[model samples]
Target: MTQHVTVGIDGSVQSAAAAEWAAREAHRRGLALRMIHVAGTEADALERELGGGAELPGRVAEICDGIAAAWPGLDVTCEVQPGHPAYTLAAASGRAELLVLGSRGLGGFTGLLVGSVGLRTAARSLAPVVLVRAESGRTDAPAAATSADATSADGAPADAAPGDVVVGVEGDRPCDAVLEFAFERAADLGARLRALESRPTSHDVYTTQAPVEQAEIRESLAAAEQVRLQDALARWQDKFPQVRVEVEVCPWSASRALVEASRGASLVVLGRRTARVPLTGPHLGPVVQSVLHHAHAPVAVVPHH
Candidate 1:
């Protein structure tokens, strides 16, 4: 069966770009395209007054029309909803094969990756979420050239597979679920899977340890941590021998490590923290927010079991 991809459109430029990217992806994957507009609190009164008439639903239709025009003969639907954008988005993600959105919304001031609805949605949604950001002309243009060369050099078909799936592997046990989800996605795409892990730095070690003997002890503890990361990767390797898996172990912050890994990756995978846990909500957490904001690729946040 064809995949079903849904993208939230708020009539913003970033959302429009997301629509365009989602439409292209839907066409490329032979999937259905859905355009959704979640009416914000500010727009609730307007929605009640207009009731699916022009401006609200009409704008959504325009965005969908643009997508349809770009990829003629593609499945497309437009919808306008009332209530919180994030709640509607999270609920819509339940049955969607994939969810696409822009990094920043109609709001103002977008830095490299500060904060936005895209980050929140990516953190909570069970479905894989793609955050479409403006791409650099020079880097984005070389895809055709690189693809052609890849096929010619390796005897690999031009469309041999889809894109690489990147998953974050922390020392935390919950990351096991993240690895499993990413491996499954890689299997589906016939793409490679990359597992990235980040450890604390030696500088932090020096600061925390005062005595020479204590410093040595801390060093040993850090080394053990790295060893645990290797063991985790080994388990994944044992489970999915056929999948091409690349493991990255570093001593940087988890967010920075993920962002670096996501540079050329098609999707970034993360594990969601439990709500009952302290400082584990979708919007909070350093590593979660960092990867969501900074990574150029789409992110897939899976719940911890």
Candidate 2:
């Protein structure tokens, strides 16, 4: 790992918020902070100037300076690179321990769509990617964390009590890397870990079973799911004994369950396949794509084989 946190800066409020979040995260991880602004070379400068993007460099500089002064002794650097935004950031992820980007807002990524920079970079990133949302009314993040504050994105105030770090677990396709990331993050924040698994309730129209029988069937399925989830989390729980682990087995859509869990969570984590599947899903699973767009908390997309 490169031992640094990389954040894309575009001078928007959302990007500024992302920069602030990345700075705190860098401090927590004891890593350097790198702020990169992407605009084409001299040849493309005229286009940028004509397009009214000339002021971005100055704004990026100001943001960098503010963060640097606020967190003394932090190695913060700003650079202007020339290339496509998505491709450049994806490449940077290869050399970064984590990549942070601004979510929907003015001049920020409006959506994690198929042709958008956010989705493209997240899909191709070598390291984990975190998407931060900062709207006009969003509170300014503190320069340093003085307390165990777990401000949430889903309507929780800045001074709200610490919240759990929720992680979605695919029982059938259990991913150790995803679990490891979640455990490490929970340990870092000294927060609780909620391992949630959502199952689609079975509905057999052809069956002539009684209503009581159906209830029993559903109960049995839930029990089996609970056991599976517990088994999958056993090793991780042992590894991070300090982290309080809570498991949930619900009969509902995975995306819906995850979105609901994100409401009061400090951070939401899910896994993505290392290989791109080339579909509307950004090569990421459907559930992941949905959660990325709708998640109330900052979502961490971890890549695994």
Candidate 3:
């Protein structure tokens, strides 16, 4: 069966770029593209001005109709939903191969402060979410054209090495899957894979068994923890022999660490296997959401794969 990717669109230029990006991706992967928009008070007013019926579904159909016209041969569907944009988009993610949203939406704020829909979907959605910021052109172009766009996003100097595939790694089992996915992506792009482990705060409180004792034990356990992290990196390198790997351990929050590491990266890949890694969950995890919100590089979430 052909895969399906859903992109949130609200007729903004960024959203249009997202739609074009999704369409190009669908074409490349032989998949269908679905464009969705949640009817907020603002969107409702705009549709009314355009003589669209003052209803949620009508606005949705209007958006989808435009997408269908843009890429006549490809399969495209538009949906208008009620309630919060992030909630609806994240729920739709369960059925999609990927969920996409532009960094800035028809809503307010630009640059670092991404729209809530993009932020929430990236952090909470079960499907991989691609948070994109468009170039001066569209995503529906030939391979060489699209590649040039991708390269421009990376800001790579002509003589420098290609961009790397950056992924977050920790003690969770999900890190294993993340490493595997990142390695494959790096190999496919002929890029290096950079893995980072974000250390938690209260670093000295090493005692998990007894809260009081743990406070006193942190100093003793800190060095050992660093060694354990090094071992994890060594194991990953051993497993992916063909790929070049660089590992770093940082004492920053996971979100901050990811944002810093994502600089100049071709793609930032995050793992979403909350059942096995509950700390990274819907509506809660800061690290997952922060990367989605702040990273200038394109972010890719690997959902339980």
Candidate 4:
């Protein structure tokens, strides 16, 4: 079976943007694109607006047509499923190369940046889920345009140099899946990989100790952290020699550091740990949640043990 890129679609602008992003990714990866629409909830109303039943397929067809137009030569397919949106989308991830969804959906509080369906799907999906906001714009652009013209207000390129992938490293529980995904993406794009490790400052040690002791303690801790981070990345770095690796060790909140790094990143990769107790449900860590809500680039939430 050919694994294709999948995106959950409703009538929302965000989902439309996700479909476009997924189409571009599928084309770049030489894979097909699947646009999935789960019936029920707000989608039912959308179906009705599109004339329902026979006419509903037209709406999906229209979306597929637009994607085909945007990404010529790319294979695209559409499906309408009947079930809870989150559960259906999560189940579809099992067979997809990657699952993409919008950060915000239609049936949610205005202030909630990420909707419940997207959150639940990201937490439960076995495959990596990429959350794209409408503002992410069309990712299918010429290399020159994407690398040089997409700029911030200050006239700096919005994305990482030309090809740069950023992955957040958790020292306590470094996820192999996340690291592998980052390295693989960088290798595929012939890009550079940046591994970011963040640790909270030891405020107590600094506050209670003398200046000399503080200097010694801080230096000691920083050295140990650098060594640990290098050890964690050693095997992977060796595995992908083609990918130039850069390691950043920061004394700050992981979320803040990752979010800041994402400003110029092609993609921000983070790990979602499965809940030990199934009944407690999926546990998306604070860092992952914060990055998803704030990162400027598309965020990939890779689930790992």
Candidate 1 per-residue lDDT over residues 75-142, each given as its tens digit: 88877776678778877888787788876521234354534576667667767677776554323221
Model 1 stretches astray by more than 4 angstroms? 1-3, 24-31, 41-59, 71-74, 105-116, 123-126, 137-164, 171-174, 203-230, 234-242, 277-282
TM accuracy, model 4? 0.82
How badly does each model clash, as a count of residue pairs? 0, 0, 2, 1
Question: What is residue 100's positional error in candidate 1, in angstroms?
Answer: 2.2
Model 3 per-residue lDDT tens digits across residues 1-305: 35699898765656766776676566545579987777765757576678765344443454455556545567776666756778888888898888888775222343355666676676678877887766534443322333332322223111235588888877434366667767865775678888777876563324365545654575445566666766776776787677787776667888888888877887788876545345655552556666776776777877663
User: TM-scores of the models, in the given order?
Assistant: 0.70, 0.82, 0.64, 0.82
Q: Rate the local accuracy (lDDT) of all candidates.
A: 0.67, 0.78, 0.67, 0.77
Off by over 4 Å in 3: 45-83, 105-112, 135-162, 171-174, 199-242, 251-253, 272-281, 302-305
How far residue 219's Cα lies from its native spot in candidate 4, in Å, is 2.9
C-alpha lDDT of residue 182 in model 4: 94
Give the worst 10-residue stretch by lDDT in candidate 1.
138-147
Name the regions of candidate 2 deviating beyond 4 angstroms: 40-44, 47-56, 105-115, 139-161, 205-212, 278-282
| Selected candidate, larger TM-score, 1 vs 2 | 2
| RMSD vs true structure, all candidates | 6.6, 5.7, 8.1, 6.0
Cα error of candidate 1 at position 261, Å: 2.3
